[model samples]
Target: MAPLIVNEIISPDTNLLIAFLIGIGFGFVLEGSGFSSSRKLAGMFYGYDTTVLKVFFTAAITAMVGMLFFSLFGWIDLDFVYINPTYITSAIVGGVVMGVGFIMGGFCPGTAFCAISIGKLDALAFIGGLTLGIVFFTEGYPLFEEMYKANYLGTPTMNELLDIPRGVFALGLILMAFAMFWVGEWAEKKFPREEY
Candidate 1:
């Protein structure tokens, strides 16, 4: 009858090894989930298929609920978990850029890597573009540094920022996801297309 100690259980090297193993599993799942196919991924935007939405939302909810449950039961110390700081302006700008990239490239970072590993030519091109983009960013970091650091909103969770309980936000997200799923289901029927 002992509680689970999930934080920093091993040395950094061991943690990295675990990360590698987890990454392998993640890559396997992505490939198996048809994320390696640009056409399938692109179908999300065109309303042809919503596998991406389903998978992404399912994963998010699962992680959210699991974390909540774990913290409730004191199995994991929630304080040790890293939450991203809310940089409102930069977050919005970066997300918009990434959204455009997703639509244009048909591959986010993880999926692009998985596709590249599977010998996808388009994914390879995307990777090249990503590398060039990173290089450009680094080279022009000086010029963009000010804008990047302009919005200095320290790490504030939704609960902190909105003065609402975390559970309320989680519940809201779940409801919104359900609504989107309903729409996706309708769209799938309304515009059935041959799958790639």
Candidate 2:
């Protein structure tokens, strides 16, 4: 079984088939989870519905814990996994831009796509705006390229930066997620909104 598992080869056709299946599952789950509703997603910022926050944090923590467990068990190769190369300036600037866009547009890229797929006209307009924003970014890329590429710290994780073990970081994240979940539950009761 170990030999079969380690030596298993996926043909291009099989890989594409698996990719399609995974994509379909992802789309179905997103739609079912109310992610296809921009208002539901935007409600996180308004303290109306906190489902988005709960789902997102839960997913993040789950993935973090799973990856850590996989590494501990030697089931996955951590070294082969790609990590984001830190560019301090770009990270700050990009985060600020994303925050502003979220506040103004009330939809992030993935949720906007999900909403668009479900025939939300607002999401369609948001997508149009996103395209324009992308075009503008591309046209202005040269101007920002230097700053964007500056202050590079190669693939540094929070564990490496803070001198903490990955498991400890993952555990902390889980605790934080639980705290957020509790707060989200309270907020939902404290500030209830009508369901659409």
Candidate 3:
């Protein structure tokens, strides 16, 4: 039932169509959640609002739990799932770069697109810069190839890396998420902001 396209249950075209629909739905949800507002998103950094953090944490935990249960129920084959190969240096560099971008622009790439759908001028500018960045990265790939490929770690899930059972890892993450939610609530109360 899972990986319908790969399993040949759904045609490639249908897979792409589904992806497009999902993208539209995702953008709609983002906009509805006030994610299109840079002020709201930036509030997470200022400790005045933690909606972004909570939303992302919830999403991560939900997916982790969903996959674990799906595997247990044999609804999906965990082995068929793709895990990205880790390059330590590049991962650190990429994370730092993205973090800086999020801080400065107050929007991640996906949210930028979501904002653009609502005709946000700032989002347009962000997307312009993002496009330029992409072009620069593509053109400069050769010069950055060595660093990008450095410290290769074969794809491994957190449970695998920690030598723990997946269920145990999922439980630990769930608890962590709950704690973060509490912290987020405290931050919002401690640093109140005017409505955006």
Global lDDT scores for all candidate models: 0.85, 0.82, 0.89
Sorting all predicted structures by TM-score, with the top scorer first, yields 3, 1, 2
- lDDT, model 1, position 98: 82
Q: Put the candidates in lDDT order, highest first.
A: 3, 1, 2
TM-score (C-alpha) between model 3 and the true structure: 0.95
Pairs with steric clashes in candidate 1:
none
Instruction: Give RMSD to native, each candidate.
Output: 3.0, 3.2, 1.4
Q: Output the lDDT of residue 191, model 1.
A: 79
Per-residue lDDT tens digits for candidate 1, residues 29-56, read: 9999999998888889988899899899
- Residue pairs with backbone overlap in model 3: none
Mark the regions of model 1 whose C-alpha exceeds 4 Å error after superposition. Answer: 1-8
How far does residue 80 in candidate 3 sit from its true spot (Å)? Answer: 1.2
lDDT of 3 at 167: 93
What lDDT score goes with residue 188 in model 3?
94
Q: Please name the candidate that would achieve the greatest TM-score relative to the true structure.
A: 3
